[model samples]
Target: MAWIHLLIASIFEVVFALGTNATDGFTKFWPSVVTLVAAAAGVYFLSLALRTLDVSVGYTIWTGVGSVGTVTLGTIIFDEELNAGKVLAFVLIIGGVLGLKLADRKSGTTQPAEPEPAPVSV
Candidate 1:
């Protein structure tokens, strides 16, 4: 599904981003190479997902997933920071994503619903 493809692309994006940070101003050869490979895969899969999903929705989903994943990974893996404010902000981001999914489901946006009756001819 498009969501799966988008999430896969997000993982690649996070990998590429982390690799880029490890490149040290492009002076590091191996890290740069990894960055390139991961970036290529990220773009390829993102494009594939766009084939079925609207660009706006696909882009937001991809960005949201990648951003959250990267930030969480940084904080947990590297112990960057996980203060109360930052944690609350992350919570808000998660809440926003949940709201989007729930709204889409409740609205039945995936498939058109029954049309309303035509106005009276009188």
Candidate 2:
């Protein structure tokens, strides 16, 4: 469930990023309005996941995934300039996100770790 919210947050980040790019320095009214709304939603869900997740870890994955998604979106949607360098950097970001997911699983953050029983004294 929390992971689902994280995914939602990532998608909202992409939407908000694209909205901002279209806003033209924030002077544009409608795009700016839309951007703000999307941004609010993005941050809200991000905060929701933080309830069960660590700040540094959650933020690392949330923002990393969002950043990579936004760039890929720009390339496909707006036909933006996507040179090899940019693609390589995006791939690195993706790899970093995957590594974090693996770490989360191993650390038992993705699932509740087993509880330790209290020791009995004689």
Candidate 3:
């Protein structure tokens, strides 16, 4: 399913992000290689999701997943600051993503276009 691809893409986005950080400006060989591979995989999966999902909705959700995952991982692995505001923002982002999903399901991907007006008299 498209959702599965999106999920994988999002996870890979996190992997590549962390791998890039670990690469030390690509000076490290193995980590840099891993980072590049992860980046490619992420894009590939994202492309799969985009085949059926709306671009705006799919891309936003993808970025949201990657962002939330990256930040959470940063807190756990890199010991980044985990503050109240950051937590609240993360929750809001998740809520927005969920809302978008529900809306897409109810309304479908593309909205109906308005009918063209009749030609005016000269």
Candidate 4:
């Protein structure tokens, strides 16, 4: 469930990034609205996912996936360059995200135990 939320958030992150580019510094009304909405949605979903997933793991994956999506879409939509270096970076980012997921799975989702109250004075 958390993973699903994270995935949704990541998609929104991509949309937010692409939409920001189209906004032209918020000069365009519709694009700016879309960008702001996407940004809000991405953060909201990310917060939901963070309830279960560790901040370190969840945030990293969100940004990593978002970056890859943005670049991939940017290339197609904006005609941005897609050189070997960028491709290599994407591969590395993806590999790191996968590694984090695997590690999280192995560790399992166990919240820390709450500390007990100290004994009352006599």
Candidate 5:
């Protein structure tokens, strides 16, 4: 469930990034509105996912996936460059995200356990 929330957040992050480009320096009202709304939603969902997932793992995956989505979509929508270097970088980012997820699953701890309370001196 937390992973699902993180995926939603990453989608929103991509939407927010692409929408920002359409905002025309925020002069375009509708695009600016969309960008702002997407940004808010992304953060909201991310916070929800963090309740169960470790921040280091969750946040890294969020940004990594979001970046790949943004670049991939940007090229198709805006006719931006998609060079081999960018493709290679995307592959690495995706590998890292997958590795983190696998590590988390194997460890059986999505988040860090709470520290034990110290004994109080009488």
Candidate 6:
């Protein structure tokens, strides 16, 4: 559930980023409103995820997701640069996110397995 919230929040981050760009330095009213709403939602979801996940790991992933998504969106929507180095950076960011998830899972932080009780002799 927390992971789901995080994923949604990450996507909202992208929306917020684009909304801000469209706002044109706050000169645009509707885009600014949309940007504010999306930013709020993104923070809300991030808070939800933080309730269960470690702050260090969760926050890092949150920012990474947002950054990667924003860069990709910029390239596609804004015709921003998409050089090989940028592509490589995107791959590295995604790999790091996956690594963090795996690390958390390995640490039994995501969902813990129940421990067996000690045998009791009468």
Predicted structure with the largest lDDT when compared to the true one: 5
Query: On residues 1-122, what C-alpha lDDT tens digit does candidate 5 reach at each position?
Result: 89999999999999999999999999999999999999999999999899889899999999999999999999999999999999999999999999999998998877654578999999
Residue-wise C-alpha lDDT for candidate 3, range 28-112, written one tens digit per residue:
9999999999999999999888887888888899999899999999999999999999999899999989998898888877444
What's model 3's overall lDDT? Answer: 0.90
lDDT preference between candidates 4 and 6, better one: 4
Error of 2 at 51 (Å): 0.9
Q: Which regions in candidate 1 have their CA more than 4 angstroms from the true location?
A: 103-122
Root-mean-square deviation per candidate: 8.8, 6.1, 8.1, 5.0, 5.0, 6.5
Residue by residue across 1-122, what tens digits does model 1's lDDT show? 66688889999999887888889988999999999999999989998877766565667677777778888888866678778987887788778767765665576544433488999997
State the local distance difference test value for candidate 5. Answer: 0.95
lDDT of each: 0.79, 0.84, 0.90, 0.94, 0.95, 0.90
All candidates' TM-scores? 0.78, 0.82, 0.87, 0.89, 0.90, 0.87
Best candidate per TM-score, number? 5
Question: What is the overall TM-score of model 2 with all chains considered together?
Answer: 0.82
Compose the digit string of candidate 6's lDDT tens values, residues 1-122. 88988998999999999999999999999999999999999999998888778877788899999999999899999999999998999999999999998898889765433478999999
lDDT of the structure predicted as candidate 1 = 0.79
How far does residue 116 in candidate 2 sit from its true spot (Å)? 22
Against the true structure, candidate 6 reaches a TM-score of 0.87
